[model samples]
Structure formats: C-alpha cells, structure tokens
Target chain A: MNYNWNWGILFEEPYFDWLVSGVEWTLFVSAVAWIIAFSLGSIVGVARTVDSVPIRAVATAYVELFRNIPLIVQMFLWFYVVPEMVPDDWGRWMKRDMPFPEATSAIFCLGTYTASRVAEQVRAGIESIPVGQRAAGLAMGLTTVQVYRYLLVPVGYRIIVPPLTSEFLTIFKNSSLALTIGVAELLYQARQIENYTFQGFEAFTSVTLIYLVLTMIVVALMVSVEEKTKIPGYGIQKDK
Target chain B: MIMLGDFDFGVIVTALPYLWDGMQLSLLLTGLAAVGSIFLGTLLALMRLSSIRLFQWIGAIWVNFFRSLPLLLVIFWFYFLVPLIVQGQVDAFESALIGFVLFEAAYFCEIMRSGIQSISRGQAWSGYALGLKYSQTMRYVVLPQAFRNMLPILLTQTIILFQDTSLVFVVGLADFMTSAVTVAQRDSRLVELYVFAALVYFVMCYFASLSVKILQKKMHK
Candidate 1:
C-alpha cells in the first residue's frame, strides 16, 4: 500500500486534452469505420445470398480472408505491407501526405474485419425473412432488384437492429486495436497518461468507464429504435 | 518477380525455431484461457439464472463490466495493477493469461446463458419428477444437453481465442506475433515476416471455423 492516489493529475492541462482528443479519435475511427462496415457488409452479405456464383464466391472469400486474421496483424499489414505493395507515388502519399495514416488504416482494417462479422448478421437477417414475402413480391411482377429493394431490405434491416447494436458496440471495442498502429485513440491516451504520471490504475479506470458510458448510450438508443421499428409477432422481443 | 525479390524464405527458415517457441506459448495461453473461462463462465451463467437476487446481481455486474471494456485495457490493468496488489512481480505471460481468462469469461457467460436457456423446461421438470434436487437436476440432466448444444459455438469462440492470442504482444509477451515482429525487425524484412504470420493465422482459424460449420450442420441433421 505504498502508492499515493493522485486522481488530480487527470484534470491538469495537456493531460485532459490528451483524453479529449483520445475520445474524439476513438469515436471518429469507430463511427467512420462503422459506416464502411455496414455499407460493405450489407453489399457483401446481400451478394452472399444472391444466385450469381462469382459474386457469392468473392464475398465469401473477402469474409474468410479478413475474418480469419487477427485485427492487429491486419492493421500492421495495412500500415506496413500495403504501402510497399502499392505504386511508389501512392506509397509515398500514404506515408507522408495522407492525414492520420494510422487512423485511416485502422479504419480500413477494423471496418473490413468487422464487415465479415456484420455480413454474417446481415445475411442471417435477410435469410430469416419468410421466403413467401420475396416470392410474393416477385410474383407481383416486381424485378428481383426491386423486390429486394422495396420489400426485403427494409424489413431485414429492421429485424437485425438488435444484433446490429451489439455489432456497433463491438466495433467500438475493436477500435482499441488501432492503438497497436499508433492511432492515438482512448486506449493510447490512457497508456500515455500512465507513462507520464505512473497512474495506470486511474487512467485505465476512467477510460474503461468512458467506454462503458459510450456503449450504454448506444444500447439505449438502439433499444428505442428497436421498439419503434418492431413488427408485431415477428422478431424476438421478450415481453415483460 | 519483384514480389519474389522482396521475400526472403531463408529468413523465415532461420527464424523457425524462435517462431516455434512462440507458437507453443500462444497455444498454451489459448488452452489455459479457454478452460479457465469456460469453468468460470458456467458458474456466472448459473448464478445469473439463480433465483436469488443477490447472486444474480453480482453475476450481472461482473458480466456487464468485463463485456463493456476492451481486452487490451483489461490486459493493461492486470499487467500494471496485479503486481501492486500481490506485493510481488507478475510476469507478462501470467498477467496476460489471467486477463484473457477473466475478460473472455464474460463472453462465455453470455453464451452459456443462452445455451442453458435453450434447454426445454420439460427437461428440468422431468428431473424433478425423478426426485432430483435442483443442483442434481442441473448437473445430470440439463447441463449435459446444454454443453452438447454449445460445443460447436464454444469451439468457434476458441477459434476467436486463437486469433486474440496475438494481443499478448501489447503486454510484451513473446507470443507468435511478437516472435514475428522480432524476426521482421532483426532482418529488416517486415513485409515477408508479417505476411507469413498472417497466413499461418488465417490457415489455422479458417480450418477450425470450417470444422465448426461442419459440426453445426451435422448436429442439425
């Protein structure tokens, strides 16, 4: 019990700024990456359900490749190997002129990695929809594209709101892997604070609490969305 | 030709012994964490399902707190904080193992909870009709079925555990990723070393997941 508790150092200048910017970067990386994950995941997921062999094969390959590797390794590859693989000009730009290279690469790595997981959810959501609905739409003279667009996609997305919420939270947590590539996110800032003040306990505790708060907010928002969009007697909603 | 020029298979050949040593440590951590988490997680899941209010609250909080935070943060907490609490030195390997087991238990707890709940109520009622106590009924009747149902999902989670074992590098543990980084830095062949490591991971996880899929299909049939 020789340690002196100095929780006050957190409020000091530069330290506070580190935490603020850390939160900003963490949120920025997660939010932008979420957009990529959802969009790409939806496309790949829908493709997986399609009849075309090539499209399905490519989508499955993307999921297998990205989902199998660890996020940190992928981030490192993006940070290091990808630059060398590209043309000399683009490589130089990535290393030099590209802003927030670590963040950008982290976003890509996290996005695509989580996209595989999200794609699984999206595919499951779409598959869960009754086949009769798709058949009904098609039987009414709607094109396959229009049938999916107007009938299936909207309902499938609504049905998946709960799993999507968990996925959203997972992406936020996974964003912490960005620290390996030096993304200066919340976890990185916590490490910096610990290094500077030797207050590892306080720094990590606060950051963990901040993350808990972020996830709680997300859960609450998604809960409200789920309630509003719920179709009667369809999806799993436990009645109290 | 340019791709072939950048890669030095000789470097990987030379680094094989070191990488093998690291892979052993990674596998050891995964096995240890997997067993420890499942045991602890099953307990938490049972507690969450218990009729007692206090037990349920404690289990709920533990699962929620761990589930909310990142694994890296938990690893850091153990690496820095455990030594202080124990009044002795805790090495990186032990700290990382403890962190993974505890953090992963939260996930395992949720999975086990769902698995337990998936069992039909009639199964438990039948045990009661046989004059079995609550604990005995759970042990003999309900748990075996739940465990069977959860086996593939548990194995899938272990595949994920194998991928996450790489995170030990953050605590300076000489796991597989750390070994790769060491070889890459020593020989200035970062690209080749990383690509090789990524391939190893991808192959292992991909095959394991494929087996999980097969098992899932077999079980359904």
Candidate 2:
C-alpha cells in the first residue's frame, strides 16, 4: 500500500466536531424514534390484540401498509408528498413548527415504519400470555381494559423486551437513510466531509466504526436487560 | 413555472432506452450479489456453528461488522478504498455489487444460523450414528433440512437486497433510480420522476414479495 493512511484527519478539530455532532444526531434520532415507535407500537399492538374487529382491522391495515413500503420511500413521502397534499396553512405549520425540521421528518417516517414491526412483536407478546391469566382477571371481576392494564401489558413488555431491543437497533440503523433528505446526521456528516476533502475512504470508515460501536452498545444493553428480566428456572419464555 | 400537466410524458417515453439499460445493470448487480451472498453466507453460517473457537470468532466478527454499518457506507468504502489500496480501477457497479454481497452475507448467515439451530440436534447425531462424517452429514442431511426451512426467509432477504440495489446510485452507478434522477434533473421534474421511479421499485418489490409467499406455500406442501 503506497498511499499513506491519515489517521490525523479524524483528530483534527473541525472533523472531530463533525464526528461528535453526527453521533449526537444519530443518538437523538434513534432515541426519539425509539420512543415514538414504542408508544405507537404499543397502541397498535394492543389494538391488534383486542377482540374488537374494527380495531384489529385498522391495526392490521396500518402494519401491512407501513411494513410493505420501503423506509426511504416513506421518508420521501413524508418530507415531500404529505406536505404537498396538506392544506397550505397546516402544511406551513408542520414545516415551520417541527423541531430540527429535516431530522424530525426522518424520525417521524422511520419511527412510524418501525412501529409497524414493533406492533407485530407486541401483538405476539400480548397474545403469547396464557388465556388463563386474562380469564382469571375476568373471574376476579375486572373489565377487559382493566385486565390488560393490570396484567397483560406489563407481562408482555417484560417478555418482549429482547425483540423490542432488536427493533430499536433496526430503527437506529434505518435512521441513516435520513441523509438523503439532507439531515446532518452521522452518515450525512461523513458525506459532507467526503465532499469537502474527497477522503471518501477515511470518512466512511470512521462512520462505519461509529455505527459498529453504537450497535454493540445497544446489543450489550439489551443483553443486560434480558439477563435482568430472565425468570430463574423458567428457561427463556418464548414469545413468537 | 413548470406545470405538471404541461410537462411532456414523452421524456419518460424517450428515456425508455436509458431505463432499460439501467434495469439491466440493476438485474445484473442483484443477481451477482444474491449468488455471492448466498455462497459466502452459507460458509459463514457453518463457521459460526463450528466447534472451533477461532472460526466462530472470525464468523461472529464478520457478521457483526457488516450488519451494523449502513449499506451506503460499505459501498463507499469499497468504491473508494479498495482501488486506492489495490491500485486498480474497480468499476463503480462492481464495487457496489461486492459491497452488497458482503453486507447481505452477514444477514443471510444470521438467518441461516437461526434456521439451522431450529432443527433438533438429533438430526446431526443420527447422521453420525449412520457413520457419516460431519461434512457429509451437513451436506446430505442437516443442510437439506436447514435450507428448506430457510427458503422463505432467503427469498424475503432477496427482496430486501433488490430494494437495496437502489443505494448503489449514490456511488454514481446508473441504476434505475439514478437514471430517473438524471432524466428528471435534465427536465426539472423532480417530483414526477421520483414518483415514477418509486412506483417501479414498489412494483418490483411487490412482485418479489408475492412470489416469495407463493413459493412458501408450495414449499410447505
């Protein structure tokens, strides 16, 4: 290899700032989208599991539509098409009022798309609980909502934690697609740095390392959580 | 002041040649990558499941590194880095294809590993009891069952890879999306052009998914 590998570019002040800002945006997007996806997923997941036919139908439709569409396409649709379709005042409000406008749109798009997958996981989690638990709640004179609130949701969340963590990591990786719409996240920053210095290898390699670190951190955290929640002697409660 | 209706669809009509050219590139990339990934992935899966500690570590690291990074970054690394190091002009499409194969192999390995693990340990033991070597057992018994179980998932991953082929456009390869973008830029019809391109992608992916479902049903029987 005749070419010198300049590790110093990563240490340079401006590049360091770009790297940190990129990591921050990456975390911010992942955290915000995870929260959004979790909330939306729980709601839709509950809906899907509920006995009400209409609720199930709506939830199923939502999951099918979002899951089938590509995340990039969804991001574009949210950033471009939805705004165009909205009435002028509302559209302007959305464009102007959203925090970190471009990043927010990406988060919203990624979050909702991921929520569909999370929703399915949650539904499976909820359904996996023995029917006897719900029956016992009903026998104890609790309403359906009360049974879910007091029993099912908590147990389901605990059981589904592992899969939910996998979903979060996925949403985190998918956030990189936001670069297409000009979000100055890690991948986007790398692209900017590359454009400026024409150091594509250096820029991409650094970002790849950062992503690897982030994902490893997520996996470690999830594993610890899984260990913490493991019920002794009840070998790995399987949630489909 | 370009009105949507006033714009000629003839641009799209005329760009059919370019679109066909791009489609051929897309298909070639997808096919080559799919085949490469499946081969590499199967080997990685076996390595991961091997009794040897060193092989397991190597396989684990390979899967971890590839799966964690975004596909675009991988493509960029190969496109820019490999040439600088190797002192050869690798074509943009080849770099993109190699990148996709490498990245996707990790995912396919994981899927295959899971499928293999799902099978009972007795399957392998029985082969041993029948005097088969490990390699022979894997080839004749374990892999046959594991591959069947993995067929649907592999097909699903293929659909994913097909969509991911669009990412190659970022590296300046004129795949379908890139061609659309080029034509659209010339005519300043970003929205329409992107919309049409997305429809093409959606149609391709939709059919891929549908066929997978059909195959899954047929395989199940």
Candidate 3:
C-alpha cells in the first residue's frame, strides 16, 4: 500500500515518444495482419466447403495445423525456426537483412494463426445458409464460383458478423504477443516504461486504458460493418 | 528449402529431465486454472442467467472486460498490479496461475451460458409441471443436461489452456516454453529445440482436439 504513484511520468519526453511509437507499431501490425487474415481466411474457408475432396483436405489440414498449436509457439517458430529451415541466403535475409525482422515475422505469425479462426467463422457462415440456397443458385445456371460471388458471399459474410466481430478484435489482442520476439508494441513499451520509471502501475494502467479504447473502436467499426452488410432475415439481429 | 545442419539431438536428449520438470509445471498450471475457472465460471454463468439486473450486469462486465484484453496483459496485471495492491511480492507462478483462472473464466462463462440456453424451454417447463421449483428445476433437470452437452467443449477449452501455458514465458515462469528457450539458447540449438517443443505441443493438443471431436460425434448420437 506504500507504492509511489505517478501519472505524470507518462507524458514526459522520451517515455511519451516511446508510447506513441508503440501504439503506432501495434496498430500497424494488427491492421495489416487483419487484412491477411480476412483474405486468406475467406479463401481457405470457401475451399473447405468446396466439392474437391483434396482441396477440402488441404484446407482442413491448414486449419488443424494452425489452430492446434499455440500462437506464441508459432511466433517463435516463424521468428527463429522457420527462417532457419529455408535456404541459407533467404534465412539470412529473414533473420538479419529483412527490415524490422521481428515485426515482419510477428505479422506473418499472427496473420496465419488468426486466419484459422477466421476461416472457422467464415465456414460456419457459409454452412449455416440453407442448403436450398446453394442448390437454387446452381440451378439458376450460375457456376460454382459465380454462386459464391453472388449468393454465398453476399449472404454468408453477413451471417457471420457476430463471430467475425470477435475474431477481428482477437487479432488486436493477440498482437500483444509480438513482445515475445522484441516488437516494440504497446505491452512491450509498457514494460519498458516500467523499467525506466519504476512505476509499473502507472505504465500498465496507461496500456490497459489504451487497449480498452482500442477494443471499443474495433467493436464500433464491426457494428457499423454488420449493420451495413446485414441481410434480411439472417443471423440473430432483431429487425423492426 | 531447408538446409540440414547445426542441429544437435544431443542437446535435447541431455535436457530431457529439465524439460520434463518444466512440462510438469505447465500441466500443473493448466490443471489448477481449469478447476478454479470452472467453479467461478459456472457461478458467473448462473448470474448472467439470473433475473436480477445487477447480477446480470456484473457478469456481463466481468466477461466482456477480461475477454477484451490480451492474456499477456492479464498476466502482467496480476504480476505487476496485484502485488502493489496487496503491498506484497507475488511469485511468478501464483500470479500467472491467478491470471489464467480469471481470464479463462470469462471464456468458460460464455460456454456455460450458451450450454444452459441450448436446452429446450419445454424441459424446464416439464420440470415445472412436475411441481419443481425454479432452483429445483435448474439443479435437477437443466444443469445436469447442460453439463453433459458441454463436456466436449469444456475439454476442448482445457486443451487450449494447455497450449496457452506457454504465455507464462514472459513472466519467466519455468514452464515448458521457458525450458525450451533456455536450452535452445544455452546449447545453441535454436531450430532443433524449438521444433521439438512445438512438436510436443502439437502432438498433445492435436490429439486432444481430435478426441474432443470424437466425443462430439458420440454425443451427437
């Protein structure tokens, strides 16, 4: 109960700059990683629901492989092990020559790992549509790809808003794992601030607030997307 | 595109005993946290389902707040913040353990809530027709069925908890991940040791998840 409290330390010169940069890196990494997750997840998800047995198997294997392992472990693998497994020159490029090697690996790791979860959301969305919808689309002379583009994509994505909302926010939370590999993100900066100022409470409090605000922003964004993309008579959304 | 050199199986072989000890710590954390969260989580779930708006809001806030934060942040909070609040030093293991329980409780509460909701209203009504009170209906009819239906999901979450024990590495708990990193650094066998660690986790969790799937299939019938 006798610990010193200092909220002012956060606004000081170097620490302030550190925190600003930390937030930048966090937003940068998570936003770009989300782009990868959504794109790859949509493809893998559609592939799983396709008629090609081998494609389904590959997609299923990708999901299992990514989902079964811990993200921290996968981050380490991409950061350390996977780079070493490549050709020597490329390994050097990844480990030494690459720009922001740690952040780059972290983006790759978080992107692919969360892609598996997003794929599940996407898959659930697609599969939840009535079978008759797919049958009807095909019966109307639409090719499989055209069916997905017109009917499935339009309806399926809307149905998955609730689940995908969680998945979207999860990418932000999981970006904190970048600290393990020395990405100077929010959590890492919080630790650094604590180390410098001996104000662990103040440092972490700032981070906690930043993260809570970040979550709200993400939720609000998803809510808007949900409202905009909502299909009539789908999902749990109540209508007027 | 992988070169095949600079790996020493000897390093992993020699570190086996130490790694085993670390594995025990990881399992211990998962076990203790799983048991602790289940009780707290079930209580929270009941609170959410209860008629009192106050209880419902408290449950909602607890789950939403914890679920929004990173697990790493929770670990840091327990380690750094709790000690200052209590004015006493909390060991890394206990801090990590408490963090896991509280954080996982949020997830468990959600699962339990849905499990409770999944039951047909007719079942509770049937109990009412048989002259059961609300508490009696929940205890004797609804909860038991919910637990049975939720067994596979609970097991799957436990598997995830096992994988998540690795996050304690940041706080320097000597869990399996820390042990792997330590040996990988000390013996200079980064690729080999890390690959082995990931393989061990993969085998354990992959099989655990498969079994959960099988249980789901059996429960389906």
Name the candidate that leads on TM-score: 1
Write the residue-wise lDDT of candidate 1 on A113-225 in tens digits. Answer: 88998998888888889999999998999998998899878988888888888889899999999999899999999999999999888888889889999989988898999
Model 1: which residue pairs collide? none
Kindly list the per-residue Cα lDDT of model 2 for residues B1-221, writing each as its tens digit: 22457546787888889988987888888889989998899899999999999999999999988877877778778887888877989888777888888999999898888888878999999999999999999999998899899999998988788878877766779987678778877887666666667677777777778888899999879
Task: Count clashing residue pairs in model 1.
Answer: 0
TM-score of candidate 3 on Cα atoms, chains taken together? 0.95
Reference contacts preserved by each model: 0.74, 0.30, 0.75
What residue runs in model 1 are displaced by over 4 Å at the alpha carbon?
A236-240
The CA-based lDDT of model 2 is what?
0.83
lDDT of all predictions, in order shown? 0.90, 0.83, 0.90
CAPRI tier for the interface of model 1? medium
Models ranked on TM-score: 1, 3, 2
Interface RMSD of 1: 2.4
> Model 2 chain A — which ten-residue stretch has the worst lDDT?
A231-240
i-RMS, every candidate? 2.4, 3.7, 2.8
Q: Per-candidate DockQ versus the true complex?
A: 0.66, 0.38, 0.62
Model 3 Cα shift for residue A146 (angstroms): 1.8
Candidate 3 lDDT score relative to the true structure: 0.90
